[model samples]
Target: MAVIAPAGDRITDVAGITVGHHHRIDATARVADPESPGAGWATGTTVIRIDAPSAVCAVDVRGGGPGTRETDLLDPSNTVQTAHALVLTGGSAYGLAAADGVMAGLEALGVGLPMDDQGHVVPIVPAAVIFDLPVGSWDRRPDAGFGRRALAAATVDVAVGSVGAGAGARAGALKGGIGTAGTRIADGPAAGVQVGAVMVANPVGSVIDPATGLPWAATALDLDTYGLTPPDAGDVARLGDLVAKQTVLNTTIGVVATDAALDPSSTRRVAMAGHDGLARAIVPAHSPLDGDTIFAVATGTVHPPQPDTVPPGMNRDVGLLAEVCRVAANVVQRAIVGAVLAAEPVAGIPTYGDVLASAIR
Candidate 1:
């Protein structure tokens, strides 16, 4: 059986994986119809770099309006089975440019697929973006420079909430931001395996239920875990107007990683399960207006039970791989909830905690 690890709440708990963030948050600036350079900048970029020897990778895109780059190559049938880095950012499709900087950085470190005996190499960096044009100056999206800066800042210490790709994110009418969670197998055939997830929550749907003014995931969890509580029913009922004004420009993009050894196919399955967790945390997920995507990376530091060890004629459903998928779903759900809880008010948008406060007042 697997147990949640208490320490290292972020995805960096997965060995060999490091996260970095670069964003610009302007609380007092006004959004200009005309493009502005430094002022009114609320968008940023995040980079997840896989360490030496690369790692198996795959992705699953569920939202109708996903903004991604090089996702097609992640298909199991494709030639590339690993990725050097993954980028998540704001600015809709324009944010995809952030990956170019990560690619350049990795190439500088001599990481990527070798093209020849010469020092030439192409880093496989897949990226996804959330539409956040209305949150800041329309043209102040992330560029290659943002990506490079994020990569340079990569470390095991991850900063959550209103940072990186989530600087301008919104969950319904409430502020959304980056969140992460992790788990480790304590005792079982899967012992020592670690699973973790990090998410930029900007979904079109609400993470809070207006009826209770608590995160939807709170139904099965203790609100105290997120420093939250149930608001007075009368107060919650009074906030009807805010609940109706859901943000339309949104997408929840994230990555799930594990230290367990897995192939591209298995990693893709884990990615799919991450979406299930998304649905569990957010109401009406994977909508046409949202570009929800999840990518999975395996560092292959721990070996799972080999299929050959299973008895013949027995179903393969019950195994270490299955346990990993289950944990991935759980961690993804926790990460999304954490994102909403950690988020701070930005661009005039409130956070779940803000709503709870209003309900109490």
Candidate 2:
């Protein structure tokens, strides 16, 4: 029996993992907040592409108010399926339109599912957005150009923080909104599987340190101090008040993937696995106003073991995936926190660093 090969962060399960971003408008031009008034007003898009074998995919969304397009295609029941692109942007629901440009890019390459008589190339593009209500001055929206640019720049080596949709974004009381990512490996389902996570943090709540109430090691004094903080149980009473505000300081969108040889159903299981990663990392996640969506992809270029193929020395591998999931979730959670702190203050948004300092090891 052949042993499954292992792929770390730099190498495959998902090889050629690339990311790209496009800034359509400056912050002063468009804003999500009117009352506080952000420093920069603008629009932008973040595109994450995973070049895989066949066009098989799966997803799990746990959001009361989600703004997405082409999500229905991920259903195992759907026949016309083939996803090549995922768009993450800043215009809240308006950002869904950014998929148009990506559609054009994919269509040009003859990607996507088969079309009917009308030549309607059904491109599978799943997207999520962050509320920019705090940067309330400019007209905020995502356009086809933004989508096209994001797709055009897609690559395997992607950067994190204060870029793309994260531009002019906010979190907590500090400058917010941005993308962050991480990867890990395990033994069984985890062995030979390289798990990676990428996310954009934009939440409608305050950020505090998990270790300490002040946010970060001791109290953070930086304008961008950001750490980990789960919502206090006592604050549940004020839930109604928090939801009523509906501001730009809200939500974080993310995708987690592995180079595992799994089908849509299996991938769905893995995607759903991310909920734990979210729960462990984010405070008050999956809220009514937040759209926390995770996408799982399998780049079949690297073949691995099947789920049924249980053998010796495999239990350790399973532990690896479990650990990978934990690390991946924690990394994404920090990414959300970093997104808030790394951003240059827009309008009058507080930053993660301003609210809490980073305790990332």
Candidate 3:
């Protein structure tokens, strides 16, 4: 039997989490002249804010060329075990500056670690960026201001695709953007725990199957999430052309949030498992050219299910941790598909919908 997600099917389904996007769509010009001032300014930033001032967080970086900020602090051995915000943005290495803006915003709200006797606070905002420079105005990428605007616009109602950090994203030969999905553990030891993920899809690989004009993650798609139609003969035929045009500069970054109470080490494992979703959706993922990363955050709202017994060498929490990890991977896969499906064509790149429509036409 297929497992269906609860209504909303979004990362916000996890309590106390809100998402916001800030992107520039005005620059639609192709990346013909890389030296132009606004040649690739079609990028933006996405902010994931945790209402909890100090949400326990962990990160897993699988790609070889990741561009990130403050990730070292997320290490299990680091003194700070929590973060106030997570930023995902486009503009390659330059986009890491956006996290500084997020930190400034959090500081204004008095949300962060207390630092001095004078009531100073330092917001723990970790961030990651994708290389969308080749697709849009590379000269005009995201900056600190973009992060500030995204944080200001944070809300439970998220806007997916061609927005925020996904604005300039590209997946193989198709357009890529923001996508989110969530599910509740229904019948496991972790039942009632909510698991969710939000991703900025700009992989250096294809999310579609060449054999059919459909997403590789189609089996996990929910009702009407990306439409139920399968690719026609023509769509399948275009796959060869699309595959031939594949390039190498890209990355996919995201966060997996859950209501289950998990320690930092357990959360790190969840973050690692979350990458399975990326592998399921994108072909040839985590390549040396891609900077794929996933962060796991636990709001500590729901307690893990208690195991009946604990063996001498094993811990009782392992069962519940396994269930959370499983759900985390599933939601990540769903979110990646949602990102591709929700995407809109920009800078001459065709979206999944555009490809399907062209195929049927």
Top candidate on TM-score is 3
- Between 1 and 2, whose lDDT is larger? 1
lDDT of 2: 0.59
TM of each candidate vs. truth = 0.91, 0.75, 0.93
Per-residue lDDT of candidate 1, residues 1-361 (tens digit): 1112246677998988998999988766443333442348888999998884748999999999999998999999999999989999998998888888999898999889999999899999999999888887778889999999999999888888888988888887788888889888776667779999999999888877776787674743456566665677665764457777564767999999999887788889999999999999888899998899999998888885545567778545347778888889988988988887778777777676665674322
Candidate 3 TM-score over all chains jointly: 0.93
Candidate 2 per-residue lDDT, tens place, 156-247, comes to: 65554556787656554445556454554545445555666666766545444333433333223332334333434433323334334535
Give residue 265's lDDT in candidate 2 (0 to 100): 65
> Which residue runs does candidate 3 get wrong by more than 4 Å?
1-7, 33-40, 220-225, 358-361
Segments in model 1 whose C-alpha atoms lie over 4 Å from true places: 1-6, 31-39, 52-54, 304-318, 358-361
Each prediction's whole-model lDDT (CA): 0.83, 0.59, 0.83
Poorest stretch of ten by lDDT in candidate 2: 1-10
| Span of 10 residues, lowest total lDDT, candidate 3 | 1-10
Candidate 1 clashing pairs, residues 3+ apart or interchain:
none
The lDDT-based order of candidates, best leading, equals: 3, 1, 2
- Summed over model 2, clashes come to 62
